[model samples]
Target: MTSTPPDDFDAVVGAAPSAVTTPTLEHTAEHAAEPRGSRFDDWWARTVYTPARQRLWYWGAPLAVTLLAAVLRLWNLGNPHVLVFDETFYVKDSYTLMHLGYEASWPADADTKFNAGDTDIFTSAPSFVAHPPFGKWMISLGLAVFGAGNSVGWRISTAIVGILAVVLVMLIARRLFRSTLVATIAGLLMAVDGHAIVMSRVALLDGSVMFLALLAFGCLLLDRGWFQRRLDAKVARRRLAGGPADWGPTLWWRPWLLTAAVLLGLCSGVKWSGLYFLAFFAVYVVVVDAVARRRAGIPFWISASILKQGPATFLLMVPLALVTYIATWTGWLVTSGGYYRHWAQTDGQPWAGALNWVPLWFQNLWHYQTAMYGYSINLHVPHPYQANPLTWLFMIRPTSMYYAGSSLGQNGCASANCSSAITSIGNPLIWWAAAACAFYLVYRLARYREWKVGLILMGLAAGYLPWLLYTGRTVFQFYTIAFEPYLILGLAFVISLIIGTRTDAAWRRKRGLLVTAIFLAFVLAISVFFYPLWTGQQVPFWYWQLHIWLPSWR
Candidate 1:
């Protein structure tokens, strides 16, 4: 498989220029080049490489795809007219949060009563929810504008972020792969993928986590380019002045890092699992900085990066993330009705007085954190739809979020028997093929040491590897939605490899394009076939059964 040269930024309009030149980049570009696709290359050069046109594609393509994604996720979004799966928990919590400034409990049969149009469902007492309130607050934003009792309100936020995630992945792929074509394909693939669509159409935390994490990732990518430009400028200045440079430049005004920290903080606000991405990206960014310095001929690059830039990045990211996380609890802290809000006052602990400097609500927040941690860790009850993480990539089993069986003359069933279901399943062609393509990514990382490959792999790992630690706990295939963009990126990266460069032979390039088109066509076909399952549309039972290629999908 072919990998794009790191320093081939010249071929990519609007890419950063680094002062450091390496023999590896020159060699790889030369070796990967073929000499037969002048016509295709000419079109790309004339159309996409023009500065103004490039800008249009950059801004226009993502918005177009986002519109497509929005339409797919929002059509009949209020259907089934009921809270599906975990929406029963989060939608109600969001309703109470908007009204009471915190989540409130409900009656024992709240689901039944609430679905039946009993809008006044919640009790005045606070609920002890394990997750943070920010995601629910996001839901509340939609509920506040669109009425709390409406299904569109329950799901509008996820749908919006879901569309935003499609755009974010496009920008990120553009940065990583340095090809507008690659970015457009990656975004379109994500726009059509059933997994992304399902999570977007539902009221769920994972979709928000996916969008926030991808936003942070895009910020880091921007930071890399911005830092590289600064580094190049500094290196050029030192060389022109003929001064003895001990280490390198110290870049302190890193707005991108802080932006990433803020987004990551929001990610963690949605789910604690986002902390993994925050930690992973912090290490990844610093390492890239060290590598850049070393390649720029700095003798003490490691120490310089660690002592100067490392601390700067840490200060910009970690503390901001911490403060942002604390700020997400403002609703709970300000309200007297929140669960455990008075724990410090009532626990009668010896350290309560010793810790009098801290506010009472802050003290209770700490205690609540401990209790939430325990509750999350101890949740090991078996679930029928729980899938092993090992099977996630293959999509051997996917959870059915909603299902209704009807006989003839029921609910517009035109057949003898029919079923309407909302299944959290991905397009088989995309998910299953991505599993195969990811192996190519591993190979590229090992053989080429492509930094972008490593970054994409880190995303996949951060979103996926943590689940391995909880193998005994109930986990679902839907959790993969958080990292689904990376898989699409991996697939796009592989397809780019197949398509090779503009220099590749005409026949080889055309053949590769054909293969890619055929594969995408297969994916689109599968998605169409499974669309009924994704959106809870009624289909003949045999047609629904036909979509279940594997018995586990049942």
Candidate 2:
């Protein structure tokens, strides 16, 4: 006895009653054939497409989930007062960058001094920083508002970015599934996930990278809808005017696409890996445009997209992104004390001939970027927590950001042994389920050609696939934070599949709902079980060991 097709499946492929009906382009064709005033169309508009209801969910759901995220991220944010993990680099860099307009050198005892409220230990000498300044700049905002010596100031920006990321996941899920319930589930998963919580509570660049990339993705989703509406309207006008409809008009004004490009540029400003998203999504946009044109009955859709619209789209996106990326270097550029700021005028060879007119500052910036790239790719120093990208999906080795073991009568230890630790391990149930769901999504996308699944996979690809090439590099599982949102989204999609439509037989719906509720309950329970480890809460040694089901997790 098969269950009815889910409402989300109908929303994506078009409404169908039979459980065995495979979604195909024919559903789109049938949808196009329906009259504007048809009973089904009117009913859909009145119920599912109600503007008032959409507006409420659009504003209300994101805020509700963001508040939950805020509490999770901001509570006890300053615990373990010393810098955790790479916060040693970012938090200090942020303080110096705030004062000197460039990352400055600090003494070997800087961490000890800084933690003891001696925050003014940075010197005027420039430090050779690997990543761009944007993320550190974001961290500086919190430092400026709250004192730099305050631990909360070190992480407040990332915590806020994490909260905003939850909202983005909800908004993006809503756009993809067109269901408030699915959107809320996605947001709730992001809010409660240990990986997200740990990343937010620390001063690290990856969370900022995740937030910017996710925001760019949301912008692209908006662009997809906007492009479709504009295409339809222009095609209708052309047919009404009796003009040839062999090729659709080239759309030069894509506001959302421009916005996505800028956001992606800022994402790259946080980390060079963000360029992968820009490259992947640019190709995705072209493909989506070709499909949209083909569906509008344009015979030369592929050729038109490639030849006519492609160059225009590239100009609208790439150049603006380049500018935005350069804008992020304004502080580095304006400061003469930055490392390699005068390379072209001193040790570096200046360009000859037509390019000799290039500014020395731009040449020096280019030289600095090359040096950064070289350092980044060649970094292979072995570390205890450096997990292979192959093990990242399984989370075999989560990074231990901070850990302090106490024997009895030390640091408030009541038990024989107490441990306060912050581990960047994801909730096992959520992480494993997401990993499994991702594989299923790949198969589903191939079989049904669902654009939504493809889009989600594209995000995962942008965040995860790039690291597969760098297996030899010293990387940690915490890097998965960059792609965790897509993981949550994939999991949410599978959940929707489980909770079949209301139109299913009463028994089927009841079973489906029961299964979904139980799974979510387990997920939440696992999150609670691991919260102490994720947040550095003190717990007995055995209790901490209990959360570590696998030896590698230690």
Candidate 3:
């Protein structure tokens, strides 16, 4: 049966006709012609078309899930008391940055002093930190508010960003699937995932990177809608004016894309690895632009998209990201005391001659970036916990951030030699199932040409594939935290497929719903079982052993 289009499909495209438009729904002939008998098909169409219900659930449901996520992250956030894993570097750096406006070098025993509740452990000299300073600045914001002496202050920002990430995943899933129910499932999955929970509670740069990258991805999704609206409006205007409407109108101003550029820049600011996202998104948006023009009947859509429009889009996105990235170094840029801040003056570098006209601060900033790049590429130092990128998906090795063994009488240990640990493991069910689902998504994307599956795949590729090139380097599985949401999203998308559209045969829909519920229940149960490990709660030795399913997990 041919189901009806949403009543407001045209209204969404033409709501701001002067600013945006779409060709008729008929323009997407291939997608429109696909048969839709499944219950999912009917529900998705209604959710997409019913503006009132969409508005109600989109923010309302996702925000509720985010609240649940926040409670989980914030509760017992200060438990570890002492610095854990990379927090030894980041939390102290944040404390220093808060007081001095730049990261300062610490004495060899800085960790000892700081962990003992003595916060003044820094020296007068600047620290030669590898990553950019903005992430530390965010940590410093929390420290400044809550007093750097406390563990909660060190972790609060990460927790907040982590919760916000859940909201972003929900919104992005909603936009991709056009179903609030699926979006809620994605958000809830993220909310409870052990990896996300652990990252949130620890003062690490990766959580901030995850939040910014996810935010940028959300902006790109919004931009897709924004661009489509403009495309439809242009076609509508031309036809009404009795002008040729075969070719789509050119879109020069894309504020949402610009917004995405800024967020992507911030993602890079958190970690240079975010550069991959910038590269992926730049290509993704331009291709999307070209496809929009093609669907609107442009005879030269390829030339129009690649030539006429591509360069302008690149100019708007790439350079803006560069500027935003530079802006993130504002503290280091203005200060004369950061390490290598005087490289141009001291080293007499040859590049200085060409850049002599530029301000000394900027020249030195360039020199610092060069030094950072050198340090990054050549970093092959061995780490005990470092796992190859190949095993990150399988989670063959999870980094242990904090671990302690307790006797029967100490620290509320209920058994002989109980254990408390914070292990950066994902929810096993979610990670294992999603890893399997990702393969299916690849087939769906290629064979069925499913756009949503493509989005999930692109995210995973941008976040995961880049690591494959650096496996010889000292990368860790914790880095997977950056792309874990996309994996969850792929899993949710498949589950939505299984739930089949409301128009499908009753038995098929019932079975699909039952299977989906069982899968989610198992995921939640795994999360509960692993929660103690995620939050550093002590559990019986045997219980911990049972949670460790694979031998490598040890």
Candidate 2, backbone clash total: 0
* Superposed model 2: Cα runs more than 4 Å off: 1-63
- At residue 27, candidate 1 shows an lDDT of 81
Per-prediction TM-score to the true structure, in the order listed: 0.90, 0.91, 0.88
Candidate 1 lDDT over 1-554, as tens digits, reads: 11332222112322222477666977868656745664655666677655566667656766788888888899998888899999988999988887888899999989887777787868899899989989889988888888866878888999998888888887778776777667778888999888899999889889988889988888887888788888878877997899755678888888988899999998999999889889988999889899878877777999988898899889889999989998988888888889888887786442445676877667788889999999998988889899999889889889899999999999998999999999988888888778887887788788778777788888888899888898887889999988898899888787777666655678776787678779878877888888889999999999999988899999
User: At residue 85, what lDDT does model 2 achieve?
Assistant: 84
lDDT of 3 by residue, 1-554 (tens): 01222232211110111335576767668545655355554665667666666565555777788888998899999998899899988988888777776789888887877877888868869988889988999998888888877889999999999988888887777667666677788999999999999999999999988888888888888788789888878878888898875445667799889988999898899899899999998888888888888777777888778887788888988999999999998887766788888887787563535655898777788888888999999999998888999989899999989999898989999798799999999998888989998988887777766566777788888899988988899988899988999999989887777776554456676687789889889988888889999999999888889988887787
Model 2, range 479-516, lDDT digits (tens) per residue? 89999999999998888777655554455556766787
Q: Model 2, residue 325: what's the lDDT?
A: 89
Whose lDDT is higher: candidate 2's or candidate 3's? 2
Off-target runs (Cα >4 Å) in candidate 3 are: 1-63, 235-249, 350-353
| Top lDDT prediction, candidate number | 2
